[model samples]
Target: MTIRIGKIGYLNVLPIYHPLETGEIANDFSIVSGPPSALNQLMDAGRLDVSAASSIEYARHPDKYLLLPDIAIGSRGPVQSVLLLSRGPVDSLHGETIVVSAQTHTSAALLRVLLAEWKIRTNFVTGDATAILSRGERPQAILCIGDEALNLRFHPDYPVRTDLGEAWRTLTGMPFIFGVWIARRDSLDRSGQAVRRACDTLIRAKVWGQTNIASMCALAAERSCLSREELRSYFDGLVYDLGEAEKQGMTRFYRHLAEHGIIEDVPSLNFLA
Candidate 1:
């Protein structure tokens, strides 16, 4: 059986997918690339059998998916690719407006949660974040993630930017899981063994990539036009696996989501072996 795999095409994940690029894994599968949100749509639509999706996607629709054990895009603190850029301090957000990136549901919801918990009553304006550079929008703060976050990094003009993961830690004292590799329940039922094997392969790839950071940085530099040093900095700050801390954080996050009406219900967090 052929499996359709959806991946996020970003520099931060280039290393984890090295096996696929080097043919260490089978090429019989269909591969499609998009931002995490689009990949989630593909999986929900049955267009993809498995995908590396926004972790919150699986949390949002748990019955429909199975998390591949031992793997994820997570960070203990300071994820360089997800940032909250503000014109002023977060405490001064009482009557300000914030713009949110249109690419992700999880980050946007998380932003709202953090803002609400912090008692920052700001009106959020959602739109294409990339356009913020081209259009002079009316926003005191902006929530940007993924490639957009990478773009906004080190801009001398944006002096008050905070990493969202870091912000979460300061607010809730927990790590954040951004994305996970998940198999559709129906697809897993049809090809369980292959799915397991693929998950193992990807997990191994993640480990191997971590061990060979220099080479992975080189690959990322060539592909994404990011410097090796910058890519390394990004990888160094993020965790590549799903461990106990992430599980607990995810549980807390799901409860918050359910309480705040972001998701309809909360489901048990179970991993596929």
Candidate 2:
């Protein structure tokens, strides 16, 4: 059986998937693409054997998945894609409604954690921030992720923009992992070799991607509003590897989530052996 892998449809993930798409790394696995939240749901529902899912998904159901080692979507600081855009200062948005993107789970949770850290409480509603903004209806704030955040990073309407990754780094002094590659536990049990092979292929693809950032940026520029230089800078800040520091950051995030009742408890990082 072909291993079904899910890819996040975001430019931030271009480095990893570009190589695979360009035949830099040859593989026979079936790939599915969607936003992180959709991929998380696919994994949860057993429709996907493996995926780069939101970090919160694994924290929510660690028993159902085994993490693929050495690969993640993270940033040391200033992730340009996961942003909180507010009309005024974030601290002053208390009691106001913030429209959150329906396509996010981890970023939304992280936003709550950051707001709580600042001792701010704001109401949240789920809607399409992009559509709302296009219609000239401004909510107090909007939490955006992926491509939408990149496009709105410099919007004139929201003068105050906060990069969640940067905020998390400031609050924790470590890299923030937003997405992690995970394999369904039962899929691994049934097709162990295929699952491992897919993981190895992803790691190899990531290696090629890390070395070819310029090429990736060139390809990404065609589909993005950002210039190549901006895309290069954006890619430079991203961390694709789950190193020791990243693991520590992820654990800290999970602990905070649990403390705030965002998740039931901190989960053990169960890697595929």
> 61-140, model 1: which lDDT tens digit per residue?
88899898878887888998888887778888788878887778788888877877887788877777667666765467
* Clash count in backbone of candidate 1: 0
TM-score for all predictions? Answer: 0.93, 0.99
| lDDT agreement of model 2 with the native | 0.93
Candidate 2: segments with Cα more than 4 A from true spot: none
Task: Give the whole-model CA lDDT for all candidates, comma-separated.
Answer: 0.81, 0.93
Residue 11 alpha-carbon offset, candidate 1, angstroms: 1.3
lDDT score of residue 160 within candidate 1: 88
Flag clash pairs in model 1.
none
